[model samples]
Target chain A: MTTTPTPSRPPVPGPPQDTSPTFVGMPTFHRAARAALDDTQQRRNLHHATRTIRDKRSRAVAELPHWEELRRAGAAAKDEALDHLADYLIRLEERLTAGGATVHWARDAAEANRIVLDIVRAKEAEEVVKVKSMVTQEIELNEALEAAGVNAWETDLAELIVQLGHDRPSHILVPAIHRNRREIRDIFQREMAAVGRPAPKDLTDEPSRLAEAARLHLREKFLRARVGVSGANFAIADTGSLVVVESEGNGRMCLTLPETLISVVGIEKVLPSWDDLGALLQLLPRSSTGERMNPYTTIWSGVHEGDGPQEVHVVLLDNGRTHVLGDRLGRQALRCIRCSACLNVCPVYERTGGHAYGSVYPGPIGAVLNPQLRGTESDIDRSLPWASSLCGACYDACPVGIDIPELLVELRSRVAGDRGRTAESVAMAATTWLFSDPRRLTAAQRATGVAGRLVGDRTIRSVPGLGAWTNARDLPNPPPESFRTWWARERGGGTREGSGR
Target chain B: MLEPRDDVVPSEPRTSGQRVALFATCFNDTLWPETPKATVHLLERLGVSVDFPADQTCCGQMLTNSGYGSSALPLVRRFVDVFGGYDAVVAPSGSCVGSVRVQHRRIAEESDDDSLADRVAELGPRVYELSEFLVDVLGVEDVGASFPHRVTYHPTCHSLRMLRVDDRPLRLLRAVRGIDLVELPEAQECCGFGGTFALKNADISISMGSDKARHVVGTGAEVLVAGDNSCLAHIGGILGRWRTGIRPMHLAEILAATEGTPA
Candidate 1:
């Protein structure tokens, strides 16, 4: 097994300490989103990449005559599986145990992290190689592993890019979508010594060259790592098994070569049975990568004679999932197959990109899920619900029929009602008082009309509460006459239908 | 203005229940009270009892949408009190009806008033927008209304997707003897009124509004009708600025119009 040399460099500062302040220190979804908006290069990369995937997905989806049926069945299966989750978990646990797979239940992120750490320690492994896993990212697993005195190497190419660049993932599939090949080449030049093989002496900014650079770096980890960690796309309860679907074979190598395999999977990842897995296997790849089938779909049940990892541990994580499940309206979020069709189709997500969401999950699903998982108390999560245009594109694109726009609106209301803590409450109260009475409403409109006249062409340009709005747009001027005046004039004169217009 | 026409003066086919209360929304009450007046005149013509609830007010949707839920709770409770047990509580706006039905329960629960929450939930499903109540609940699509004009329907977001009252308004329009109900292309997308959303994200809002206006003009309908005037007003404002051949009118005003009646 080739051993990648650890690059020596000044250590980067740790994760930001302020978790309680919500959006206090974080930039708004708008500003954060704006960073990538004007980068024509990044926009070209994203637009080209996303459109290709979208076209491919449409073709793949159209090939299946039962695609819609499969989607419905997938949704129904998820619903039924969630309905009987406790029973399914027990069944899953028993079968897995009988098959020589140990199952650990984690209530939240911390517990799951500790469990994975313990497994790595017990295996006496100094380093663990990882396949691409969002759950691991969500738990900040690499940071935990590093803190516990171990190196967690990312094997997936995109994951490698993010890890090597010391950056947060901006897009779910691409992770480093914000970076072009040249920037990637720069990162490789700087960080490649971390792996034993340095970047090619004359590496070009070509895609193949960058990919080869990463492959050369990761090939060593795939062969040498004693422990491997992964996140499952689906865990089948009927037969004790875990499945990782991916475009690249890196996931396969990570799953099979390691002595001890540890998987940190969200509890919501479980499917009811094998037939359910069959349907999902068909849906996931097409919706996710727009491929007819994922190139590498590695499914492992338990210990086998002379093949695969002998020591298998599955860590089932709750991590605010039960609370999400408890909500009748919100629980449907758990049904996500993570196809990311919604994200690809979302106009807001398209323009703003993913980092603005300030969570592992982004796009319409992120807007609803993040707030629900963390609760709306934080300003970041609160602002997420308002991120969408309520355009319903996400809903249209969703395979499982998660009503993202409705959920966003629901979350927005919850945020607004945060015990009346915001300035909007005061404004609403005052406005309501003026509006409930007819006479007051007319007076206020006339008053606004007059005030609108003063701001007429100069565009007021700066207002405190509304500056967030006018920053990019203009406020319309109220007409000289309210509709009431128009009506009154039409009535006073001869009542011709053509008289008003 | 026509001598303050206080006396009924025998309008055609007037209904006789004076107890019906008007829940004129902030949009209608402030921006366009003519909608409420049209509602009252229309309901009065159908011989239905109509009363302008002196305490009737905003459904608190604006505050609730803005993420200020606690302040909006009182408005929910008060609206319930003012209009709850009446024969029916009708708002000219689908968004307001949606708030009363959809959001009030949420607000009531937040306030820890289970009973009030339960009541709001119970009364909420019954609260209907004017066209919905008239057609779906009241079973009266043809209000003896006659407006000889080409009209297209704009389905508000809350009304179309939220309430899922798809064909009731169109069915009513179809039944209207003289009104032409032209099909609107992409009728389900929001007009971007979104309560405070129009002012909050005016750029995207205007973009969405322009899209909607383009659709409205595409139909070549002389008039655009919608259940919620807030959406109509936003689209109307755009149409007014662009001087499109189309004018906006509420469904209630169209249903209320009789022969020779100015719509």
Candidate 2:
């Protein structure tokens, strides 16, 4: 192997420590994946949850005769929106402002949290009730709120389970997918009292009972909350409307009950018009949670007089999104509707769970999205691209038809570029050189055959740099003679035989 | 019963005078020679002339997938050069064909080689996986082959999803006179031999392979069949280590078998 000499350069210090307390000290994907593999309960929980969701999604998608057409339309709409994102955002801002909603633009997560906090403090509210929003989690908004002396109460049942347990969410649609009924019951029994009304003293390991306990507890917070925070599924530019689809009614309660509503939406969530909502609404529910339609799809065009929250504020969050959108090859990640269907069907996510991804957005979409959204400066973000096996399941499941594997390859090339010359690069270079000429490849194959003779006809168990391949399986014994050599000897030197008889 | 989808091309026997070149892929060329031999035998039996192009090398799937697209460019150019003149190029592996058809254009575009991209676009459609060539190109389902033993077919992910060569393999297997083809439970899931993925992420790869092996063994079939040798090698390796009585065979081998010479 010809090693490319490393260019002489001054040694640089490592990437700065992630000072954000919520995701601080998170391990890289390789380490966290190893740890997660040993957790059999988490594995079981993930396997069960993903399998159930995948089967349901397949069934749900099968019911639509025009599903493929709908998927194409959804993908086309997102592409059009992404092509004109700046225009749509401006129009959406104008429409929302005209409809009696105040809009705030944030360049990053810190600015977004600061805007939301200012709004809360101005109202003199000590607490805020929240609808489960991935953008909020992505920005670690709850941690910021808590640090600023405001308690944020999660109203989504699964989100409540995760909050009460002080555990990170492991799935997109089902935040508590890592927990079973028994684990959820235990979390509720141990941690509910500190937050609000205690769980029922007779709380059992039944799912319905656990849900009821959560419902009763969140009801108290809902009635008294003066401020509500949310994330939107889609923001319509034509009407300045925001839509949130949820199985539970928490989003409705959060949108309607509070005196003031603050929505923190990613800038990429805007659609060109209300006409785009039909395909997406059909795609999202079937792809996520595998329902014909979600129970509550609340659409609000700013504030309705005395009907919903009288005061509404939409925080248009950039938060590294513009950087992602700037990438011509990678901007399709912006087309994600956050359905979590990609996660449900990804084998890597099934095995390692979401925490291994080290980002709020996990699974196949995260593998591409997180690396670009948060530059690959950190180890976790760098490792995220390699998290997938490049299976096309995510692309198949994605309602918007994001070519996730292609994006993954693109991101991998970027990550590979930063490393300059390394062992993998040298090896790949050598392999490429060998294959460039058939003669060189023949010689290499002959050498490999000679090496195979040293080990005989038995399966070898291990090799350097291939511990991963041999850890659970054995490598095949190489054939004594390569087909090229055999063909040369037996088939008159690789020339075509006679034509069809 | 799991019936074949209507989209699957019907196996109507036709004598095609088309000349074909075999891009036997580096894997079958180096390690799994039986796959290429079987493919040659099967194609020849169906009355289509087959040529083994001597200068053909790897299709650069391994290089491209390992984040070495720049390194894979020459191989792509070389592939088009070697097989560009043929009426059709056939390979035993779906993944290599998938790389050639789907990823080669991107690699060319990445380097801004318009000629290379145009060449790939011209040659991409002519490359075919084994079952696709038989069921779609040659329009033959029962290649007058018979394997008396029961077998289960694992649809490799690339063939199932990337190439969308759905049910073609199953249809071919079903038409074999004496073969009792059983459905592999959750057969559409990947066997985790994602080329370098098996090496870079060994633990996950092994876990996935073991699950696949268990399902294959559960079917009580004496042999497990698949189109791609890469997947067969990974799952076959696990089965070998576990001492399972089942053996992994390429689809070409199963399709080439006849009552007179059982594979």
- Top candidate, metric TM-score: 2
Second chain TM-score, each model: 0.89, 0.94
Compose the digit string of candidate 2's lDDT tens values, residues A257-336. 99999999998899888999999999999999999999999999987787989999999988777777667778788889
lDDT of 1 by residue, A303-360 (tens): 8978999999999987777778767678789888777887776655655667788887
State every prediction's TM-score relative to the real structure. Answer: 0.71, 0.94
Shift of residue B212 alpha carbon in model 1, Å: 9.3
- Under CAPRI classification, how is model 2 graded? medium
Checking candidate 2 for backbone clashes, the offending pairs are A468-B202
DockQ of 2: 0.50
Considering every candidate listed, which one attains the maximal DockQ? 2
lDDT of each: 0.74, 0.86
Chain A alone, model 2, TM-score? 0.94
